[model samples]
Target: MTSTGEGPSATGSSSISANTSQISLADQFARSTEEEIQFALDEIRNENDKLEKETGILTKYLKRVDPKDIQTQIKGLEASPVQQDVVRVHKRRSRSRTGSTERLLKLTTEQKCDIAQREHDELREEINKFKHETEKILDTYRATREEAEIRLAEMKKSSYEFNRDIVLGAKNLRTGRVVAERVTRYFEDKMRSRKALIEKLRLKNSTLKVQKKKLQLQLKQKEEMGEVLHEVDFKQLRIENNQYLEKIDERNQELLKLKHSSGNTLQVLNTYKKKLNNLTMESNRLKLEISQRNELLTKIDKETELVEKEREKAESINANLRRQLQDYIVPEVLDYVQVRADLYELTKTMKTWERKVDIAQMELQKYQKQWLMMREHNRTVNPWATMEQHAAL
Candidate 1:
């Protein structure tokens, strides 16, 4: 009886240890699955972050490199070489506008215009294509991340039921637990405890079967992806890359052309710029001279007005003098009492003296004749005696 009881006890203990090992294995598997799910979530999050950073960098670089200047340069390159005049800005204002073109070019302006138009159309198409590619990349990233998040949510909800519903805890413990709890009611509750323990084991067994079915369903839900990116998307990217390579070749060819022409064109452009500077300086000098002339004209006008006023004053004085002289009849007075009257009086007095002198000349002639005759008669008589008597008297 003792050996038989020991054999049954040994068998029971071996079965209990096997059950414990199975439970431990299941627990280990559940923990490992949870860790894998968390690792997958972490990987998805990291990928999403990397994609976000790349998208942000792409947008920033796109924004930083403005294409307007490139477009402008392309337009200028395609423009007619004959059309030289261009709008010039000075001091924040337009100083000169493009002039009318003349003399038909070697390759007509119309042809160059066509080339420019074609280039513009091509550029516009390229920009739109780039925009579509960017949008497609963004959509792909968003779809993949959104799908991953949805799957992660479902996985998390399903895992929440694991702690409660999975066959994860110490499951075959009823025999020992009963013996320990019913120690006070040992002899009286033996049959009841055994029946209760059997009922608990049966219930746990049913639960384990249901959990197994649910776990199989979860396994079926695990998706198998054949590719990360679609073949079509890859092919489109390849086509774009080829197009970019072609563009690079074209740009290199254009750079070679520019280098070939740069020497002469640069010298000519410098000459033209120097001439333009000289012309601008000359124009400025002319404007300054014109301003000075206008100022001088103003000064001349002022002086003319002053001269006119002075002339009017002189004329007024002359008119007043003439008016004062108009009422007077006095002639200019002579210094010697009408000097002609004095000459007339002297003439009258001279005539009267001439008459008296004529009469006295006749009497003197008669006396002289008589004296001559007497002197002839008494030449020897008394001339000496008369002279001596006159001397004594």
Candidate 2:
């Protein structure tokens, strides 16, 4: 009877120790989580402050990076001499009507370059800022994850110890009520703390998700801006190229006029070469006719007439060839012009197709997202109906 009474006391003491340990563990876990939450919040505030500082710096940098101002200074320095020369050239080519085009092309190119450079610098700054912000967020996520895991492990250990105490206490009816009460209190406290931590985590996760979406939107906008800038640059290059092509065409026309005037020398040279060849053929024919005339001198008059007619025909063919050659441009030059035209058309078509494809893909993605949302909504709202349909299937 003494051992049995002592047994109850011993079991009660052991149960009390277990309850104390469980409560201590829960308190420690709660404290650690609170500290961790506070630390995470502090880190977030610090990061926000860093971001603000970075933004301010970027703003200051932008104020210094005005490409237009630099371009204006450069233009001021370069314009004095160039303007005089351009005016002289303009007067000389006043009748050509090309001076205005040249001026417009130069102005547009300079403006486009300034715009592209400014945008590029801004993009570089933004990308660096985003990268820094992302690194900070990653660090915060890692720290929070590690702390959550540690807290979860502590909770599990405490619950296990509490459950063991309850199982041991159940063997003794006298202490069972006290152990059960303590365990009940422990569980209530645990549940309350767990709920609080979970809510905090949920809120944190929601905020992080919102921040993630905002960052993604910012990144997308930056990419779109970059593409737009690139297109502007490309358009500027195209305009300059067109201007160059116009100048080349004008030079080609001038060369053609010069060739028409000077080409007579070459044409005469070619005519002489042709006539020499015709003379060689005529000499051979004359030799054969002479040989035949030696055999039959009475038919010499008929042969002479026949040879004269052939010479006339040869002369007519030579005249036709000369006219054709005079009218023909160099084949190589013509081929180049035709190829350039084809390439331009091809580029235009390709751009149109690419734009259409991008639009179609965007539309398809939108439709797909809508379909997924509808499916999710239907499943959530009419789960029983979905289950019945599946069962029928």
Model number with the top lDDT: 2
Instruction: List runs of model 1 lying over 4 Å from the truth.
Output: 1-251, 262-265, 331-393
The per-candidate count of clashes, in order, stands at 0, 0
Candidate 1, residue 84: lDDT:
21
Measured by TM-score, the strongest candidate is 1
Tens digits of per-residue lDDT for model 1 on 49-89? Answer: 96565444333333543455544764778633322211110
Model 1 worst lDDT window (10 residues): 84-93
Evaluate model 1: give its TM-score.
0.22
For candidate 2, the per-residue lDDT at 102 reads 24
Query: Candidate 2, clashing residue pairs?
Result: none
State model 2's lDDT. 0.72
Q: Lowest summed lDDT over 10 consecutive residues: which window, candidate 2?
A: 98-107
